[model samples]
Target: MIVAVASGKGGTGKTTVSANLARVFDAEVQLLDCDVEEPNAHLFLKGAGIEEEEICIPVPEVDEVLCDGCGECGAFCRFHAIVSFGAKPLVFPDMCHGCGGCAKVCPRKAIRETGHRIGVVGKIRADRVTLIQGRLDVGAPMAPPLIRAVKARMRKEVPAILDAPPGTSCPVIATIGGADFVLLVTEPTPFGLNDLGIAVDMVRDLRIPFGVAVNRVGAGDDRVHAYCRDQGIPILLEIPEDRAIAESYSRGELIVDSLPRYRPLFEELARGLFDGGSPSGNRAGYRPFKSCQGRFRRRENGCALELHGKTCCGLDNRCGKPPCEDKR
Candidate 1:
């Protein structure tokens, strides 16, 4: 089973949950830090025998010799990676998505695809877990491709945990693709509640099973709890806002290793995830109601606007489709 730990926003302890869960998982597992832009899981789960591999994506290159810029390739490219005004097409490799559509649309077959180095994927064996992480090259135009390379290294036979990048965007979607389950980690703050709803909607759209894990449980209000309860989403595990936990994290130490008391919480999280239900008797294994589908809009109070039957929200519409209504 591949379990993904993700958040809708950054600094919500998503990686913290992922690292600790891998530490206490009873079975052999592989942890893929799919947050290629800023992978920090290695800081906590350190090991030797680190191996690295180059990752690349295909970009279009126009051949000057076979010249015929009918502008078909340029017109076909929605990203405008190729542009032509009845002249030789200008190829912007950095802007290309590597779909190869530009080459296919070239009337004169003048366009060819070339490998463009984008990032590096590294693997290391740490104790019981194998860590595979992708690091995107600086100035790289994209991250989904690099994230895909990291996921490609996942051993299908072993249970895998993916630490997805924060937010419901292209990179996060790429990382969580094909995951058996997703664990949405969040704090108890209003911001957490808002983003959690967005993340919840994302996983629901993908039709993947998911539950909530509230970190910093003691700091924020009960709105997060109310949100979960109202949505019927299971609360798998709750970690209190503790200074010792923060200190351990600052020192790059695993919570399970430095603080034994918190080990059981993560162990329970693992159990609930793999078992398909909350072992603590809280509601689990419930699919989010599709009818409750809503787009996230930032309110002054940081509450998520669940617009039933509405397809879009102004700023948070990462689906790339036209908004049904611009409720900003």
Candidate 2:
């Protein structure tokens, strides 16, 4: 099964979960870090050597010498990548979607397709995980092409985990498009719950089965659980706030490597998510860590529910709050 690890906000331990799970799986696993903007999976799974392939996007080049500057090409470009003024047609390679519409509409046949380097995809192999990451060139506006290049390396025989970019945007969609399941990582705070709701809606809209993994469980409130209960989103794993894990992460160390015992936890998480059986005993019902005290300050008196850094009230604020945050 191809599992995608995604989050609505950054720093939710999405990569951490992805790397650890890949290491625990017995079969050969591929880890595709589709977060071309900022990929960090390689840091955890160091490889001896990485095979790199340059990625390029098609851009229209107009042979100005061959023809008069007709406005037909400009009119055909829906992205406004090509603009004509008087005798010169200006082309912005960054804005081009490579649709080749300008070439088809060019009456003078002056337009030709040219390649523009956007990024590079690197394939690296560790003990169990084969890492594929896309590194977008500086100032490159498009990421979908680079993402596609990274996913092309996927091997269907073995299960894969795709580390998708944060947020419920186009990049996230591209990464998780065809995955068998999506694991939404979030913190226990209000911001986490808010973003989780948006991500949950996005996955539901895409018709993909999804589960939630709460990171830094003790650092925030229990609203994440309440929301999950209300929405029927399975709570797959809850990682409590631990300074040891934080210190190890600061040193670019994987949690499972630093604390070997945690490997079993991640393994169970994977099984509970993919296997047909019910959640195991180790993966019991969601419970808040004892240390999560004042992290979730009560937003209002007499209300057991507390709000973290931000609350999703589904108002003018774009927190993407679920319909229940306000009712509570």
Best-fitting candidate, measured by lDDT? 1
Mind giving the per-residue lDDT tens digits that candidate 2 earns over 1-328?
A: 6789999988999999999877776667788999999989999998865689899989999897975887898888888999997687999999987778898888889999999999999998998779999999899988888898889888766667899999999899999998877889999888998999899999999998777888876687778877876676655665667788899888888888898756655766555444411222112211211111121111122121123223322111112223334444
In model 1, which regions exceed 4 Å deviation?
275-328
Candidate 1 is scored at a TM of 0.83
Model 2 — which ten-residue stretch has the worst lDDT? 288-297
TM-score of each: 0.83, 0.81
lDDT score at residue 134, model 1, on the 0-100 scale:
94
Q: What is the C-alpha lDDT of each candidate?
A: 0.76, 0.75
What lDDT tens digits, residue by residue, belong to model 1 across residues 1-328? 7788999978999889999988886667788999999999999999984799999889988888896768899899998988998778888878888899988978788988899999999998898788999999999968999999899888777777899999999999998888878889998898999999999999999988877877876676767776776676755556777899999999999999999878866765665555422222212222221112222212111221222222122122233343344232
TM-score of 2: 0.81
